[model samples]
Target: MPTTALQDQLERGVAALGLALPAGAVQRLLDYRALLERWNAAYNLTAVRDPAEQVTRHLLDSLAILPYVQGDTLADLGTGPGLPGIPLAIAAPGRQVLLVDSNGKKVRFLREAIRALKLEGVQAVQSRVEDVPGQFDCITARAFASLADMLAWGGRLLAPRGVWLAMKGQAPDEELPGVPAGFAVRAVHALAVPGLAARRHLVVLGRDTA
Candidate 1:
């Protein structure tokens, strides 16, 4: 698809999501997508190939959870090619975003994207999720792992009052029972991503105070 069409699709999707992004966020998002596409050709960053599909499955799909995102610090665990992390940073500029992944190639692409897009507060770290230190007010895991395992590995990074946003294709009802102790399901939202029809859900979890 042409760049203009992709922009149109992204704009409509953002509007449908009821998000009013920064003035140039839409264009910057497209630029990020282009970078991902180019890198994916050589490094195989993501499974999705087509550019239009990238907008639907990657860009809009990531932006779908924007409304639920909170706090000034966000850590995207298993951020392969910076899925929701990069898009979220583009849409919400001021928040500090940390994209973590063990894959060196993916991290390299993420760094290039951050620099090319001039995303000031974003940083890419090539490391396992468990070893990434520091607490974040919001944490995103995009189809990275089962809820049980994700919490077991990176749960420590979530602030006492922070939220964990787990993006999944379907509601992980079976995994709810396996959520490790000290964390509870706050809510589960069915995301409606534009230009694509697929089951998408965001499982919100928080530290269990009681």
Candidate 2:
């Protein structure tokens, strides 16, 4: 994806989305895309490449949940390449973002993207998913796991009233019979991530005994 053309399209898309980013923010995403492509040559960072998909799928797809979040702090689990976390931070600059991933290389790329984007209040930590103890105002993940498994593994890290935003491809069909008690599924909403194939949706879960 060429810089000029991508910039033009990004300008329109960002405006349409009613967001005003810094001068070079779109460039940073493009740079990140380039880096991903380069790293994929050896590191195999991500299988998604095409520029539009990078913006719509990788970037906006993660951002689709921005409207649903209502806090200043967030943590992303298994944030392979900073999916919703990075994009979330970009959309909400005041947020304190904690991105966690066990893979050192992926964390390195995340750190690089953070630096390139000049995104404040962002931290990329290299650690296992279950090891992050402190709670966050909100927690987000893409392709993490089934609702039950994710709650089983990462539920404790959520603030007493915090919400878990999981980006999924399919609408959660069957009720999670084994999903531990006290946690409730709040809402299921469809996410229209342009330039991607799979249907996207968001699952909002929190500590509710209903």
Candidate 3:
């Protein structure tokens, strides 16, 4: 399929999800896809090559969690190639998003993507999740680690009453037992990525009241 078809599909997909993005958001997403493809050749940023598949797997797959996202500040931990972080940032221009990753090359790509995309209120930082400074109202991790380990490394970064959105292939039943103290699994949402056949789930975690 042509790039225009993919863009049209994306626009329809976002609309189907009942999310209203800004005027140029879809264009930015397409631009981001192109940048990812261009950089992937040299940096090995992602294994998926077909642009149409990327639209579904990479772009829409990340955008699936758009409705569940909350708050003004978000940190996408281990944001390799800026998956949901870049897409989410493009959708919500007013929100402050920080893409945190320890890999130098990935962070470099993220920086260049941010620059080329002209994504405002976004930054790419090179740091381990545990070492990242400050707090954010929302944090996202895409198969970066087990739910337990992800919180262990970055739980402190979640502000009081903040939420952690962990994207997974399926319900992480076993990892629930290993959740560290001071946190609770708020909810588990089964996400349906437009045009994606595989299962997708988002585990919501927040500070424990007890």
Candidate 4:
């Protein structure tokens, strides 16, 4: 499919899920994706190369967790090619998004995408999840780490009343018990990504009690 057509289709798909995205931002996302595909051949930044899959799997998967993201300032850990973070920023232009990843190459790709898209309210930073500076209202991870490790190494990055939105497959049943005492796990809602083979869950983790 042509890039413009695919872009329109993506907007329709997202709207079908009750999420409305701005037309210019959708076009920017499509342009960014096109650039990403071209760069992926040499950068090896992402495993997902197919254009259609990029929409349903990567883009949609990210937006599906939008409601769960609790703050104006958000951090996306292990944000390879800015999965949920970039897409989320595109969808919600008002939210400030920091895309953090340890891999220098992936961070480079993210920087390039940000410039290419001329995206507002987006920043790319290179750092480990644990050592990343500043606090965030919400932190997101996709195929980044086990829930246990996220709470361990990355938990401190969240603001005092922040939430953690994790996109994972199969619900991660065995991992819930290991969260730190302050953090509690709740609301495992299935995601509705089209053409996705595995079951997706938007796992919500948070700590509001002192």
Best by TM-score: 1
**Could you tell me how far off, in angstroms, the CA of residue 10 lies in candidate 2 after the best superposition?**
3.2
TM-score of each: 0.98, 0.89, 0.97, 0.94
Candidate ordering by TM-score (highest first):
1, 3, 4, 2
Model 1 alpha-carbon drift over 4 Å, by segment = none
Candidate order by decreasing lDDT = 1, 3, 4, 2
lDDT of 4 at 102: 86
Which of the two candidates, 2 or 3, achieves a greater TM-score against the reference?
Answer: 3
Off by over 4 Å in 3: none
Predicted candidate 2 versus true structure: per-residue lDDT over 105-209, tens digit per residue: 999988888887787899999998788878998999898888888888888988988998988888876635655677887888997664556898888888975
- Per-candidate local distance difference test: 0.94, 0.79, 0.91, 0.83
Residue by residue across 71-175, what tens digits does model 3's lDDT show?
999999999999889999988788899999999999999999988888889999999887899999999999899988998889999999899999999788888
Candidate 1, residues 1-210, lDDT tens digits: the string is 989999998999899989999999999999989988889889998899999999999999999999999999999999999989999999888999999999999999999999899999999999999899899999999999999999999999999999999999988999999999999999999988988788999999999999
Better of 2 and 3 by lDDT: 3
Residue-pair clashes per candidate = 0, 0, 0, 0
Taking all chains together, the TM-score of candidate 2 against the true structure is 0.89
lDDT digits (tens) for residues 167-191 of candidate 4: 8988888888777788888678888
Clashes of 1: 0
Q: Candidate 1: what lDDT?
A: 0.94
**Stronger candidate by TM-score (1 vs 2):** 1
